[model samples]
Target: MNPLLDERKATVEADHQWIANLEVDERARTGIPLLKVGFNETFGYYISISRAKADQVPANYIRKQTLKNEERYITPELKEREARILTARDDLHKLEYEVFVTLREEVGEQAEAIRHLSRAVAAADVLCGLAELAVYQGYCRPEMVNGRELKIVDGRHPVVEQSLPAGFFVPNSTELGNIEETSPLPDLIILTGPNASGKSCYLRQVGLIQLMAQIGSFVPAKSARLGVCDRIFTRVGAVDDLATGQSTFMVEMNETANILNHATSRSLVLLDEIGRGTATFDGLSIAWAVAEYLAMEIRSRTIFATHYHELNELAGMLPNVANYQVTVKELPDQIIFLHQVQPGGADKSYGIEAGRLAGLPTVVIQRAKQVMGQIEKHSKIAMGLREGL
Candidate 1:
């Protein structure tokens, strides 16, 4: 399985709450049956009555009658009797209409208030929900556990970490160095390893950390120093665009190109198996050039995972370029991945051993071994000849 795609899917899954809240807000604004009633309930009666009696002449008639009655108050008993009669007459229909109109106006104001309030409330809800989910799913800490800029201790995959049994799933921690006020943020991190290593997992962890930070949650490291980023670009999965008539390799290159053109120093980029979509030599050349551009031009925080060992040469020339490898210890015919990330380049790609784990046919495995030996011998001979020339 493609680890990069798996990580992206996991991130999306963990953020289910934020997505749900967004959907709710969209429905509410568009009048798509919100979960709770708004000002409509409070003002329904006022609006209904106003519409029903809008054409009535009772209000005008009562005003004229009251004016005429006010002019005949001369004797005390007669004045009292006249006042009572006038009050009763005014109360008949005009009072009700006045009360209804007043109530309608008040309700209209309330409805407008609710409309304005919904937007702010919805945005806050979404941001809070994202943070809460990050903590709950183990992508990041629920609260700031350390005084440091960021800290994540024993954090696991927000999604995969959930499926594991209660006591399983190891946690990893990260923090910036204390000597430097801020961590040395590299423009590029080159990750090299054989198949089935944890390079993809490490890349995913970084992406998840940034996502949590953006949503205003503590990260999964024991301590973290975070610089806010504007955009996160991931180019991990490779698939042919059948609709566009582009090959898988072309699609991959297009994504890479887009990233190069658009990503800024504040962006976070994760690239996995960058050149696997094309021919070996061509893919290596493109991958090498992309890495160089990220290091020299974009200068963004980037995590690039690939099987190409040639790219490791960047460490010598690029100041901020760091080499990391997913470690594996091998026996004669068995291999075990430590699932650990350490500084430096990997020396070998154990493809045959990985194929063995996948249970390839015995004959195929044997032939592969033979072919591999022949290729290595020929490569050595060619190198010697070139040196002589």
Candidate 2:
């Protein structure tokens, strides 16, 4: 049996249970009897209106308001019949009240039981979720026969695909070499590309794929060979913690530190735009050090996406590091994302073009272009001076 597919099936079944419990709770709150109540004796009594009437009757009926002045007294035969009927009715009412009370109590107990069951189902779902995510990770497990490498082919991001507008998804593939079984594993992949070129999306795809595999679902990839990972870590966006009195950079660093400390060799780590919350030099230095630590120290499979061009040099220096850039086609006054990953680092980031794409005015676009050119020239001169020094 395919363990990954089995895991996904288990997850769907568990989720169905949770869905059932929700429906049960909603019905219980509204006093709608569950079909399962058919098995109970109280439900049998409630099903028949004749039984309900026999069970309870209002006492001391006047019978007629116009006959109040008349000498309306109970006849001996009528009184005798009334006594017998009232006595039976009172007993039945007591029984019916008991049934109602018991039903209420049972509802509470059933709700609690459903709650406990739902929690168990949710826990199982988490495990299944993990297995499903493994389907996208390209890490191959050793084959049962001769330890052959398995491959993960053309994996798409399931969530991203669903969220994107129709006809916009771009497919990408990841694979491991089978013949060269001893080839070095791809541990650290550095993604460099222009802004809005799908760098973050690609990083997220990797993370999501692993997560889905762990949960035991079919991944968006056409095919996948996944090694079960211990944990998946992501340090993507930065937000200021005003209450904690920490800057955005500080918050980012804190998260990074947590991931670094907790992530194991079997973990999958995704770092996006790391160090961007601080100054260029400081951020670049931190990003470089973090990359080195992940590559040399942890040796975990990682995807690091950033705009720092200097850091891309690590692809040449580090053994397991590889540089991948998102492809973009530049037009006369516009840019389009090819949504494809290619070899080598990106030389330029078209921030102005991105701004224009976001509907910036013509004057602003022209000014941004001029400023960008000046910055590029200054950056080059500064690098040249540093090299000379």
Best by lDDT: 2
| Candidate 2 accuracy as lDDT | 0.66
Residue 24 CA displacement from its true place in model 2, Å: 42
CA lDDT, every model vs. true structure: 0.64, 0.66
TM-score, cand. 2:
0.63
Candidate 1 — which pairs collide? Answer: 150-223, 150-224, 151-221, 151-222, 151-223, 151-224, 152-220, 152-221, 152-222
Q: Looking at model 2, which ten-residue stretch has the lowest summed lDDT?
A: 42-51
Give the C-alpha miss distance for residue 56 in model 2, angstroms. 36
lDDT of 1 by residue, 355-387 (tens): 888999989889999998997777543233234
Global local distance difference test of model 1: 0.64
Candidate 2 structure quality by residue, lDDT tens digits, 68-143: 2221112233344444544545555565566678778988879978899999999888767645554544223222
Top TM-score prediction, candidate number: 2
Candidate 1, superposed: residue stretches over 4 Å from native = 1-155, 172-185, 378-389
